[model samples]
Target chain A: LAKTTQPISMDSYEGQEVNITCSHNNIATNDYITWYQQFPSQGPRFIIQGYKTKVTNEVASLFIPADRKSSTLSLPRVSLSDTAVYYCLVVGMDTGRRALTFGSGTRLQVQP
Target chain B: EAGVAQSPRYKIIEKRQSVAFWCNPISGHATLYWYQQILGQGPKLLIQFQNNGVVDDSQLPKDRFSAERLKGVDSTLKIQPAKLEDSAVYLCASSSRDRAQNIQYFGAGTRLSVL
Candidate 1:
């Protein structure tokens, strides 16, 4: 598993776009970057995942550079409900045998 | 479809006592994982199972913790002679490789308090 680094905390207002970056300097070729959102007293929820380039889903977008050392999770039009901790993880995507290892995460506080 | 289910959402026990948590993954998900999250910290993988067989348990404290996924569906995790440091949320998650993406669905988790 590749360790990830992210900001400890970030502040954003409602209707703003929030982007959290994760750095996995030792990412492997078989590794894929994944993002998960966690609110207070709840388990982490999968947000988006990508191996390379950019991947967008109904909830958020994930951008990976060519080097794959870092990735960013972008949340559009944030709302008070979007206040949560965002986690960045790099997992080995082979044969689906690998499990996720979460980090301290970036706490995004969305103010109304 | 229903999501992962866990019971005894909250538990409080004295140190050295035993506790068990149950988890029923989403139907048809072959992979299940148990994680422990301490306050202000990220979740740490304790074990991983595939179809009733364990894939990883290196992080588990085998002497005190045990888990089983009999029948390849529902699972249980147990801890005996628990220590104060063992107080944390135990999370159960399941994922299927049907899409080549291991997107896990998590249960609300069992919060354990060791006094």
Candidate 2:
């Protein structure tokens, strides 16, 4: 498994765009970058995933460079409810296994 | 579809006591995972099961924690002689191998407080 590095915390105001970057210098050929959002007293929810380039969903957008060394998660027009801890993970797709390693995610505080 | 289900949403016990948590994965999900989340930290994988067989338990404290999945549907994680450091949230997640995506659906989790 490749290790990931992200900010410990970030502060954003409502209606602003927030971008969280994650670094995975040792990312492998089959590794994919995924992000998850966790709220207080709730389980972590999948936010977005990308192999390379850009991937957008209804909730967020993931941008990955050609080197795949790093990726960015962009949340547009943030709301106070979007305040939560966001996790960045690098998982291998070569095997059918489904175990994930999580780090001390980036805590995003959305202010009103 | 219903998400993963976990029982005993909250548990409090004294050190040296035993406690157990149950989890029911989403329908047709062949892979199940158990994780421990300490305060101010991210969730750590404790065990992973594929069907009725164990896939991985490298991070599990086998000396005191044990888990079993019956008939490849439900699972139970037990901790005997719990310690104060055992206080944390136990999370259960599941995903289907049939899907190419590795998305996992997580349960609310069981909060354990060992005093």
Candidate 3:
């Protein structure tokens, strides 16, 4: 079974901010939350990852609270190209098990 | 600096027939993984390899699916008796443990259509 849960779909207008949240209540302490974006007919592309608190990169920002039960991926000023499936993955560091278990992604539709 | 590579971008085969997909990871990568992505769902890990040895394949259906990385660089995934439900995009990804993060880079994937 997948360790993460996300919405099946979301809608947003161009230039607006989009936030997608994922719940991983069973996340372990050594687990790190990573996000990826997948365009139609293409493989997934890495977005951002975080263990705790907040992690900001050029593409997006990841926010995690103290409980670490959930995390949010924030996209600033969304565009039509941002319309794609977003996946949240829990990676166990140093576990030597780098295999990723993906869940049903959240489809974000960005309209003009 | 080349990314993970997979061959036969598209394939169409009849059920019960055999098919194979090949992948070559980025140079110096010690870890390789194969995933199956059904339409309308996320990718599922089929198998994982660490330098020519199987590290994980609990999700793989051993009844029909098999994989190997002989040279610890290139790998192949084969299905002996394909089924209709086996139609999906097969993706190969590789990552380096030498780095601090375990970020995996994916290939374009091979779309298999089993009729």
Candidate 4:
């Protein structure tokens, strides 16, 4: 399984573009990179997913380099409501091909 | 288009006690997933069901945890002789069968506190 590493927390101001980067040095070719946002007491919500290059959506943009070792999740003009934990996930089937292994996520704090 | 529904939003039990959580996926989705979210961590997948069949359950702790999806619509996750380490939020999510764009829809989740 490919594990992800990210900063424990980040502090940003509202209206600023916040970028959270995740490193998966051992990412497999068949794996997919995904980002999820989670609010307090709520299940994590999908934000964006990508194989490589740049993929933009209504909520965020995902940038994956050619090396595929790391990916960046960009939230444009973030607001206080965006203050939550952001998780970077490498989706790959386990040996038995059942569940997704989640790692420790990055907590984003948007200050006014 | 009702979203995924999970019952008993909260549960508290002592070690050695048993508990069960229920989930009803989206109206037409064929895939359902159960995940465990510990505080300060991302949700870990416990099991996956493709319709009424089990797709994956390697991460589930079989010693005390078990889950089943009957009729391919509603599902249940049970923990027998719960342990303090079992304290976490249990989330139910669903996705369509398409290979591309497998976006998962999640419920509010059931928070369990094992004493």
Q: How many residue pairs clash in each candidate?
A: 0, 0, 0, 1
Docking class of 4: medium
lDDT of 2 by residue, B1-115 (tens): 9999999999999999999999999999999989999988888889889998888887799999999999999999999989999999999999897232578889999999999
Question: Candidate 4 at B31: error in angstroms?
Answer: 1.1
Against the unseen true structure, what C-alpha lDDT does each candidate score? 0.87, 0.87, 0.88, 0.87
- The numbered model that scores best in DockQ is 4
Error of 4 at B10 (Å): 0.4
- DockQ (0 to 1) for model 3: 0.59
Q: State the lDDT of candidate 4 residue by residue for A1-112, as single tens digits.
A: 5466899999999999999999877666676788888888787789999999999999999999999889999999999999999987676444534235555898999999
Task: Specify the highest-lDDT model's number.
Answer: 3
Q: Which model, 2 or 3, shows the larger lDDT?
A: 3
Candidate 1 TM-score, C-alpha based: 0.93
Return the clash pairs for model 3, or none. none
Runs in model 2 lying further than 4 Å from the true structure: A92-99, B98-100
TM-score of chain A of each: 0.88, 0.87, 0.89, 0.89
What is candidate 3's TM-score against the reference?
A: 0.94
Better of 1 and 2 by DockQ: 2
lDDT of 3 by residue, B1-115 (tens): 8999999899999999999999999999999989999999988889988899888897899999999999899999999899999999999999885232588889999999999
DockQ for every prediction shown: 0.57, 0.59, 0.59, 0.62
